[model samples]
Target: MSVDVFTFGLNHTSAPLSVRERVAVPGELLRPALDALRSTWGAAVREAAILSTCNRTEIYCAAEPQVVDQLPAWMAQFHKLESTSLQPHVYRYQQNDAVRHAFRVASGLDSMVLGEPQILGQMKDAVRAANEAGALGTLLHQLFQRTFSVAKEVRSQTAIGANSVSMAAAAVRLAERVFGDLDQANVLFIGAGEMIELCATHFAAAHPRGMMVANRTVERADLLASRFSATTMKLSQLPERLADFDVVVSCTASSLPILGLGMVERASRLRRHRPMVMVDLAVPRDIETEVGRLDDVYLYTVDDLGRMVQTGTDARRAAVVQAEAIIETRVQNFMHWMQKREIVPAIMEMHEASEKVQQAELERARRMLARGVAPEQVLEQLAYGLTQKFMHGPLSALNRSEAGEREQLLELMPQLLPRTERRR
Candidate 1:
């Protein structure tokens, strides 16, 4: 079966946080997950890459057409979820549609926060992971190279990213809405990854009374803290220290919740029920869902931040048409490249056949010359032999074909055969 571009999975728009979180693949498991995907279908999945972020988990593959239907099942099984429950939220895109979806995704046209630049970095990271896992082959490599190019073109040629609200900025806005003013609020950041760094930058601007970073790695936490002159603490210290901050932002890779109800409840009691704002930007959630019900705690997940960032998107929405036009042109070009690639095997076979014919004819010419045959007659025989060998297939097909097929062959013969000018 011919391999074609295929993309399958769900994102923030198609699935809610609860569903997305269930299937989210952590960074540490990316290589194993990729190996499992390719191993599950073997040759059916020729080339594969899994792009798993807090907002989406998509598998891009160069695979047989039949593999598309089975991909959702594989994803559900990989994540240990029931296929029936996950199938409805899944989407599949093939060939040109797959190419367009990738371009749009890299260009941030498909993000919850439209034109947000963070997703591009996240995609690059996914591609890097795929490369490290040896999951990337020619097709996916080309696709992603073009994807990056298209993203650059969209960002440079259009105003899609301008005046766009970032998730980090949105989180700060949400905090202010709850706390009235950030000047007196102490902020706690969980994790020292990119999202946390972005949130730290934005919250730093608020000039909060104090800022602290809690991470599993003290070195990473200290590194992030050094930049903002904030303090650093270990994750083990969170239960005792969680109530010190009025606002908390967490984005981590842990598969389970970092802050459970009991911990937050204890923190609330420590604070004497002071109102607190907490943002959980991790996929599986760094904070437990039940903790949101606490009377003194204002908890928000990545989805809530996404919705908050979407509010002022009208200004950036104007650039969507222009970005999409750019993506359409690029998508057509990529599909054309793929179409040309499909004919390569046929072209190779024809060349191989023609080479064999030339070799056979040349051998006959050499034998006649060695036998003391006239050079002119030998040349004539060689030409005739070459012509006959080249024309045999077409002539036989034309003779055997029925009326309609013969007529079609006759029409194609002119283009398929090289023209010969008569000697005067």
Candidate 2:
């Protein structure tokens, strides 16, 4: 059976955030998820890796024939969802298409936000986790290695990432929409993670009247705060001070909602229902959904940020043509390698058959020489025997063909035969 490369998943285009979050595997769950994927299929799947981001949940694998089709079912089983429900959202790519999809994803061509650089980092992290889980084999290893190189090539060769609008930048734009002038707004960043640090930089550039970072760990919050000449607040102080900030941008690793409706309601009451903007960059969401429903609160989730970052897609669209030309060439190169690999077993079988014929002819020639037969005669016999043995299979196949096949084989026979037979 052919063990082909495949990529299967649902992304922002294929599914909404509700479906995405249901299947999305967090960083901590990646290793176990990979292990489960391999153990679930055993020998049928030779290699596997899972890339689960806020916008996508993809499974890349090299597997035997018929195994590629099992992924949707496998995913449904893994996520404890109905197979039918997942099928509409799932997409599958095989062989060249698989490689192309991976290259596109790493290059940020397939991202919800066109040309965002964060996906490359996320893909690298997924690869590392897959490597640690022992899921990377020769096919997957070469795939990602080439994927990284292709991403680099696309980034360097084209203006794909120019004028990139990141999620943090989007959060700042949303804040400005709510308050009109960010300079007059007091911005508070909840959680000093990478997204928050980025948001802090964007907001600080506006030179907000006040900037503070609140985190469960004050050390991390303080570290990020120092860069912007901002102050750090404890998570415990959120309820008391959440009312003071006009803009709140949050991203955290917390599993549960950190900012609930009750706390925000109290905060709104204290502020006399003054308009406040809240941006949640978390997957599970750092703030509650109910918070967005409040009269004076404006809440934006990661999905909201995705739409915000799509402003200059027209410019990025031109770069895509150039990027695709590079990716198509690389895809052909990768597919050629896979094609060579597919014929390996046939090549090995031919080698073994030819070796056996050679061994038999060599033994007979040796015996003929030992029996005082002339060297010239024995050499002639060995040559004829080896030639006949080599031609036997092709000759038989050609002779057995009925009509159309026979004509094709007759035409191909000269090409397949040695120069000596071709002359005959």
Candidate 3:
């Protein structure tokens, strides 16, 4: 099978949430989507895996090289989106470039929040799901295995992750920008998911005046709230309690907007135009876009937080130089292994040819012994015959050749012989 690594997707860089959400593959639908991709494209996609988080959705495949060209079309058809809609936003990488991209992504270099460790786990989960679906093969398997090792190395050797501001941390930063310090801010979190939990953790570290977790399930909200010594409520209660908080951070999986413009306007009126900082980390966006226009409301999306988090990226430029050196060396080693593997079929063919020569000469010697030749003489003749047969073609060619031809053959003879014989 012709094997290649290819990656294609859009992320926080190439597209906004409006574009991203249209192509975001829900975890429940991932397997079916993969199946559809494989079936739609057939043999071109021999093995495939997808990593679809809120920040990015990427397809990694080990297949025929031509599939790289077909991916955009496949994605458009599968998502029921226009080709133009995806073409402007997608990035594609092939072969070593794809491998490097996968490694960087797993290592968090490609993250919206650089060097964040959560993406590595999310990638692992994607690989595991692909494995369960029988879509992972030697190429993708080795790619991900090395990707994890590279990530581990980057974390252990570099300070890339140090002093990094996570999305949750950035949400807190944006809140601080509005409220000066979070100490007096009453922080309200929407959703009891991992994102909300992480935001709650970071906001709690700021020692907010009050913290509350709101979710569809009050029990789950209460469960997460207890960890931070915060209170809990149902999502239904948010409209009434909205004005009570000075900061709201939301990341939920709801298909529709959870916090609408009217709701925030009402909350602003309730608070008498007191400024409220709102951060929407959700894909579809829990908060309405028009809410950002409200005079008393400061609304930020994940992209806004992403821009804010990029502030100290220049500081990490030194560490990036060092990390790139390590990754380059590893890439060369992996490419070398791949190069060696490519020659295996030719090596096996040469070995089979040599075995045939050996077997044919042995049979000839056995026939001489069977003809009643003396055992010692038979052995001597066998050795002589084997030597002559091996060298006959080259020696004959050398004898009939001109001066330079004979010189080259004589030079090669020693190398053609066994080591001990050549030394003697």
Candidate with maximal TM-score: 1
User: Model 1: runs farther than 4 Å from truth?
Assistant: 421-424
Lowest-scoring 10 consecutive residues by lDDT in candidate 2? 415-424
RMSD of 3: 4.2
lDDT of 2 by residue, 106-170 (tens): 99999988888888988998999999989999899999999999999999999899899899888
Q: Write the per-residue lDDT of candidate 3 for residues 59-100, one digit (tens) a residue.
A: 999788877877888888888877766888899998778888
User: Model 2, which residues run further than 4 Å from truth?
Assistant: 216-222, 233-237, 420-424
Better of 1 and 3 by lDDT: 1
- Measured with C-alpha atoms, the lDDT of residue 3 in candidate 1 is 94
Structure candidate 1, residue pairs in collision: none
TM-score, per-candidate, Cα-based: 0.98, 0.90, 0.84
Clashes of 2: 0
Identify the candidate with maximal lDDT.
1
